[model samples]
Target: MSLLDLSWRNMKRNIRLYTIYFISMLVGVIIYFTFAGLMFNEDVVTAIQNKENYKTIIFVASMIVFLFIVFFILYANSFFMKQRKKEFGMYILYGMKERQVASMVFYETLFLSAISVTSGIFIGGLLSKFFGKILMNLMHYKDDISFAFPLEAVVSTILLFALLIGIITFQSYWNVRRMQIVELFHAKEKMDKPLQFSMPLAILSVLLIASSYYTITMGGTSNLWKDYFKESLLATTVALIVGTYLFFRQFSGWILQRMSRSKNYLLGNKMLWISSLRFSIRGNTVNFTFNSLISAVIIFGVGFIAVDYAVKADVVRKEYPNDMIFSSQDNRTQQQIEQILNDSHPILAHETITGIQTEKIANRKPFLDHPDYYTEEFTIFPEAQLNAIVDLRGVGEKVDVKGDEAIVLTRGIDQPKTYLSTLPTMTVFGDHTFQVVERIRFPLLSIPTDASGGSEHQPSVLVISDEAFEQLKGTRPITSYEVYKIEDPKTSNNVSRQIYDIVKRTEGSYYSAFIDMYSIDIESSSLILFSVAFFAAIALFALASVIYFKQLREATEEREHYAILRKMGVHDNVMKQIIWKQLLFVFLPPLLLGLLHSWFLLYYTVILIIKDLPALTTIIFSVMGLYVLTYMIFYVSSTSIYFKIINEKNTR
Candidate 1:
């Protein structure tokens, strides 16, 4: 028979074994094809505001997906090749040339790739409309998306996967050509030496990881990070990578060794799996460490996206309480804005806030420690007017100012400690020294000015008693904000645009419209969330498949040991218990450590910026629960397949 016929028969015989590999490839193809289709979809391109940016983001995301698929396919191919080494060896022993065997392997891979790509593209085309609708909904686009199988996307996907298949076929051909017959026959029997614990390395691993965490969390305040930020960041990343590797390579083995020596080591089938794990630790260490790090990345990425999407509206509203805000010294300009808003939408509330701006404050000593905390200009508001504005917005709590006391609001500062107690007293106009009663992190108004617009400078805000404010009103440059809350602010884009044009043309005047800023934020965040969700899905799938494949390979190697235990009168329940323990050992460590790492990362980074900690915590836990559920599904599948392999009658 020709090599092609033999290769076809081999594939048919081993179809069951190829099921996971084929599914993984199919999923990769579907993701790539779907993303490509969206990139070329006319509806999506036209509906989104920034067409170039949208296309660029999708293109970059698709490239990343393609790279990941390449890695996954290559890894899967290597596993299959390793599993079939003995078969290749037998083919050589039966007088078949090595070239023939290699050709056969190539043909098998080619056939599998063709089938996977064809089926995957067909499914991807069918799912494109559903995914498009999801993207549109996330982006808050009202237009209906019509499905079209873009010829460009189809041709591009075909060409890319075809190149991938060619590369895979060449790799299989090369791997078969280079393998010695003896090496192939002995490949299944080859195992790493038993793990040896090293005290020095274990200690180093702990120190490395601990120091890296400290650097990431606390280093921002340190001079090293402040002065050499890039270097510090790079060092932290390197330390984390090396530390994680050492953690699995040495620290984990040390712990296992200690556990094996414990008094209860031989209890309840512990000896069965514990002994096996100790021997296999050397082989599994790298995989465990890699999966752990990837898990952390996946969690951190998804957690940030979830929190960002959840809190976007709240953040926008907090920053801009008034649906439309503009400052104008010209009464005619103000009248024009009022006319524009009144004609376009129903007005919910309208209020005016008068404030004074100062270039300097007499009590600058409090800000000496962090000069950036002090702005060149300060916007001072009277307690009554500020309280009225807050009450009108119906979002924030109303503040009360007592005699000679002021409440300070720092623009864009999220951390409470950064603003609270840092400013105890303020002397405005170089004469009136007021006691600082409380400090708020966000600004009261959203308009950009010398007090709020400069880079790296926070706008200083003070709300004093009404009597105190009247005393200094004539001494400083006065500014007034015409704030308006209109009906359906989020949907009033056209009205916002009209007002924006008028405000931009007026001298020394600016405006903040809720729809303008909120739409950009919501759309960008929605796109990020959509992309990240899929990336996380792909990572989880890959991680699970890697573990599944490794477990299956190990099961094949340990089948004889299991068969011997069965003959020695081990019960079915007892054998299953052993398998469960072994698989749990493989799956649990990475998950727990990854969770811990991600939790710390988010706490130090993402959590600080978020206003709603309780909501963010809920989102994080939900993500964790979902991640755990996915792993559990894979764990159960691996265990069942492993049990079947071990209990098979013909394991030769």
Candidate 2:
């Protein structure tokens, strides 16, 4: 057959295998683009928006996804090469030039890349709308940004994979180039010699394990440890990864080599264990390597999201205990609020607070930027309305006033404009009556009920007294409600809902605190689930599928070689042992190393991620167990197919 004909035939014959590759690529696109959409969604973006040098997080995350795609696709290409090695080797023996064969392989890769990319992009377009909906739900997106084709993001994604395919094509060519005709034809005859452990390797492994433990545990979180030990911690992680590989290489082989020595203990499936372990290491060199890589990724990935969820989950409930939060323009509902709270729940901690928004003046006179802090916005606010809204957090607490004059608290700056890095400037207008009081800080978290142009993002108001607020706000009404922490927030919500029913039937503009809390919870949960599902799918599918596919090809190749030994008088049991044995050794080192690598990764991720330590551990362990179970099942299924193929070829 002509070279073009050979390439075309291979594509058709290997269509099933290529389908795996194509599907994986397409799935990866869906996953990554979904992640991008989530990050850029308006609700989630509010958290990330222009927050002090935070644009880099999106860029870094995107780059990681792009690089991962490139590497993963190329890794999958190894299967195409493995399946075709015999063909390439035989063609060379039959007088087909190496260059000609290389050209053919390159053409096949190019054709495959083009086809896969086209299919992926087409599928991506269809998935985007559904994907967008999922993202909106996750972010609890109250606001929306219009979605278009996103030519820039999509085009960049395409070019990235194209470059990756180009690299894969060249790598395939390189493999073909390095092979001699004899080795190609006799490729199945190549054997992996048993490995022996060196003292240096064993010592290094011990040292690496020790260092990794110390670095990861880090004792506790502190600026002192973080500043001085960060680099060292990173270095130790690298060491642990390297050490895991080394340990696996020697330890796995050493165990198998010593297996036959313990005949008494070697009874039962000891043979299977030994055999499988060896074969795993040998035939699955790359598989083992990648499994380790994935193990590490999951350790960090799941740990981060789970921990963040647990921590934030608690804080949000305490901050907003009710369903609907609203404030009016006046402060006259103190008695009504108490009545409602008593009516809603018997256990109510009723209190009234007053607050005022700060004002500034260019001269002795003052002008208030946002004076609505004295107005009654929410029905649950304090009696005088200026108790806690004015003069809070950064600008207010640090200032001092003498007699009629006041200087607002402000940070000393390297430059005038840059002083407000995380703070706002104290403004003044000409000839405005301004009296600065003693600056003081407000509470950590509170939303502005003062909607008369008062912003929630800026510094807040603090009320010194009820009378002061009443004088400032001019008969504004205060928010009225019962504030109490129940034994169960979940149950508290239900009770509040019941009370809300009562309020709604009897009055206008009546809202339940329970509804507000429930809505926020729903929003947060949706976003968390959205992020976890999309990212986890990408990580799992890419890492697991690649290892599984590679292992399948390797098993097939090993089955061919094992059959030759069977004909040379090795017993059937021995033949099976050998086949399983090779896989065990090949798989052991990489898989074990990968697990260790993941362990350290989980530790570091826990440090950076804000959360409960227990949750992080749980997620890491769960993901690791999952990878192991999936791999085991895949191995069993592939092994059966592997032996079946060999049996058919031998009969032929």
Candidate 3:
């Protein structure tokens, strides 16, 4: 028989073993092709209005997918070769040259790669338009997308897969050269060696993981501990990687031993399951650790993306709660502002807030031990104007300032101690002082000069009685703001963007600053949301591939032990149960640990990125649900494959 005929027969015989690799490659190529089509989609490009952005996303995402596919396919090739080492030894013993054995293996890999890539591209092309619509929906694009051939995408995918197949074939050819006849025959049994661990190493692993969690949570906060920021972050990341590996390496066997100590638990096939888990752990420490970290990375990365998108979208409304605010110097400018406001949309209501500027303003917060804080000049308003604007905007109740008391609009301080402790009194321009009766939160009439853009300042806006305001009046420059509320605030978002564009076109406009809430939300959220969602999908698919490939390898190695159990009167039904239980034991630990890791990640993420954004809670829960569903599919598929492998009647 020809060598090609023999290779074809070998491939047909071992097609079941190649299932994981085949599916992984197919999925990878499908994603690549679908994204390529979307990148070239005319309607999508028009809707996004940025062709380069879509192109860049597709290019970078494709490269990431390609790299993952290369690593996965190469690893799968080596794993299959390792599993068939004994068969290769038989070939050598039958007077076949090593070169002939290597060529046969190469041919099998070439055939499988060709089939996977071809099938994947055909399916991907069919689904490309559907995924394009999904992307358009995510980006809030209104263009009606239609399907196309995406000939360039097809050619590119084929070329990329061809290169990948070539690389895989080369790896197979190189791998068999190093295999000796004796070692090849004993390759499958080599993993049965006993594992050793020390108490000190085990303790060290726990300490490292503990310290990593601490650093990630509390060590990165600023103010006092800002200097060691880089060091703490670096230490935590390293500790997590090394500690996670060591933990799985030593902890696996230890767990199995402890579980076996209960006599009732070790009864029947329970002990066999425990034994199988121990063997999997001790022999595959690196694989277990790798899969665990991959799981953690998927959860952490996807969770963060969801949180960031939600926060960015929410921040726009929080920053600009009112419809529009524009500063004017005098009546002429104020008239222009009113004209533009009326032109933008039907203004339901408007408020004119005048600021009497005062410098060298001293508040109690700065004089306290918090000397690092500095106070800026403030715009003081009288009680009546404050009440008029507050009531017109329907934000807060009108404040009553009594005697020498004033209401301070504080900005930029999250902690109450830093803001409220020094608010007992306020001094304006040299030595004039007034008692502070109340301090309101944010969104005052005039635009805040602070970074937060809210009323979170140290006496930034002081509201006093008209009589007191008249007394402190000086030659200092005055600033004014014209705040307007439109009849339909939601529809006015587009009008707000148009007005902003008009202002940009016309130089020296009346409005010193413009706040368009909807425009800000849409402009920032679209790119961030799309990029994060795309990358998350890529990472998740890659993680699934890695875990799936690893599980298949484990199933292949454990087949013989299961065959023995079948011979010892183990029924097929009982063997199926044991196989699934064992697979679950292997999969669940890493999944649970990954969730625990995400908990620590989200703890800090909520406080920092999604600060005070209540909407993120719902978004986070939804993301978690999606990830769990994906994991469920992976688990079910893994169990099914495992059951099929261990129940086979022939296990030579």
Candidate 4:
């Protein structure tokens, strides 16, 4: 028979072994093709405001997918080659030339590649429009996405995977050519040396991981982050990676060794599983460490994006309380705006807030860093006008200030005690001292703050009693803010644009439209969430597949050991229990560690950025729960497959 026929027959015979590898490659191709098609889709490109940036993001994401697929396919191929070494040795024993054997393997890989790529393209083409619809929905675009298969995308995916197939085929050829006959025959017998537990290394691993966590959490508040931000980040990353590696490398082995000596080791099936785990832990250390780190990253990345998308509306509302806001004292301009807004949408609340901008403000807190806080002017409003505006919007609580007391409104989400404590308790305005009694986090007006202008500092507004405001009003220049809350602000894009045009025509005018900012924020957050979610899914699939492949190989290697145990009267039920316990040991540790790592990372980082902590927590835990469920499914599937492998009747 020709090498092609032999290769095809061999693949058909070992199709089960190739299933996971084939699925992983197929998924990779589908993701690449779908994203490439979306990037080239005329509808998506033209609909998005920042077409170039959107294309760039999709291109980068597709490239990352390609690289990940390459790594996954190459690793699986190498594993398969290793598993088939004895077969090749037998072929050599039968006097088949090494070149011919290599050629057979090459043909097998080529056939698999062609099938996967063709199937992936067909499936990806069918799903591309569905993905486009989801993307457009996330962007809040009203237009429907029509299905169109871009030939360029198809050609690109074909070319990329063709190159990948060539590389993998060459690798198979090289591995086969490098194998000595004797070595190939003994390949399955090569096991890693037993690990010896080092007390110092175990302790060092704990210390390193703890130190890494400390650095990440405290780095933001310490001089290390302030003086050397990038270096600190690098150091933290290296420490965490090395610590995680050592954790699985040394600490896990040590624990398993200790368990092997424990009284519980005498329990039914415990000895069987624990002994096996202890023996194999050394070889599996790198895989365990890699799985742990990738799991953590996926959890953290997906959780953060999910929470960000969830709270996007809250964030937009907090930053912009009014639907339309612009500073205008011109009667003609105000009348024009009122006429346009009243024509289409009902004005929910219209307030002309009169305030004074004064640079004569003193008693600024020493802890505040913004030079603007100490030098720049502050907009001071009377308690009556502020209360009226708050009542009109129905957002923040009303303030009741007496003669000498003032309420401070700052730009940011409210943090209990943090903002109140940092703000000065007293302020001096043009020689009149007033006590600052209360602090509100969200800005009452939609005027731009220093933060909106790309500065780190937030703008402050002082609200005093009408008596105190009258006392200081004549000392500073007066400013009037025309703020309006219109009906259905989310759909007020046309009115918002017209307002923006009118406001921009007047110099020194400040304008903010809720719809304008909301649209941008929602679109960007949705896109990020969509992208990160897919990326996480791919990573997760790869992780699970790797673990699955490892366990399958182990099952094959341990089949003989099981057959011996069976002859010695070990029941199938007992063997099944043993397999379950063994798989649990392999799957649970990395998942628990990953969950813990992601929880800490999000609590310290995302909690500070998001206002609604309870909602954020819910989203995070929900994501973690879903991840755990996926792993559980993998664990169960692995266990069943493992039992099936070892329980098969011996052909020998």
Best by lDDT: 1
Model 4, residue pairs in steric clash:
none
Task: Give per-residue CA lDDT, model 4, range 1-652, as digits (tens).
Answer: 8898888788788777777667767887888888888888888787775566688788888898889889988988888888899999999999999889888887877777788888988888778889988988886776677777789999999999989988987898899888899999998787766788877888788888888888878737689899999998898888888988888888888888888889878978888998888788888888888999999999999998898788887778887777777787578878998999999878988888889776644535532334353334567899888888888788877778898877767655444233344435554554676666666665765544221222223445778899988988875678888888788786666677787778778776777767777766776787788789888877887898788889988998899899999999999899998998899989998888888788878878887656655677788889999999988998999999898888765642
Worst window of 10 by summed lDDT in candidate 1:
447-456
Count backbone overlaps in model 2. Answer: 77
lDDT string for model 2 (318-365, tens) is: 343322333331344434543554555444233323333334322311
lDDT score of model 1?
Answer: 0.80
Candidate 3 lDDT tens digits, 15-119: 776665577677778877877777676776665534565578667877776786677667667777777888988998999987888788767767776887788
- Most TM-score-accurate candidate: 4
Model 4 segments more than 4 A misplaced = 42-47, 91-102, 126-148, 198-243, 262-267, 327-346, 354-384, 397-410, 413-481, 502-509, 606-612, 648-652
In order of appearance, the predictions have TM-scores of 0.80, 0.62, 0.76, 0.81
Provide the lDDT at 198 for model 1.
96
Which residue pairs of candidate 1 clash? none
Q: Rank the candidates by lDDT, best first.
A: 1, 4, 3, 2
- Determine the C-alpha RMSD for candidate 4 after optimal superposition of all C-alphas: 5.0
Clashes counted in candidate 4 amount to: 0
Q: Which residue runs of candidate 1 sit more than 4 Å off their true CA positions?
A: 93-100, 137-148, 199-219, 222-243, 258-268, 326-345, 352-388, 395-410, 413-482, 498-509, 606-611
Cα lDDT tens digits, model 1, 1-652, are 8899898888788876777668877887899999998889898887776677788888998999899989988989888888899999999899998778878877877777788888888888778878889998887777677877788898999899989988887888889889998999999887778868898999898898899898878736679889999998899888888888898889888988888899999888888888898888888888889998999999999998988888888777766556877776378877777787788787889888888887676555453344456665678899888878777777666777778888767544443333345447776677777877666654666644221122234446678899888887875678887888897786776777777777778675756766666777777788789889888988998898899999999998888888899898998899999999889989998898888789888888877756555787889898888998998899999999999898876444
RMSD of each: 5.5, 10.8, 5.7, 5.0
Between the candidate structures 3 and 4, which one is better when assessed by lDDT?
A: 4
State the local distance difference test value for candidate 2. Answer: 0.52
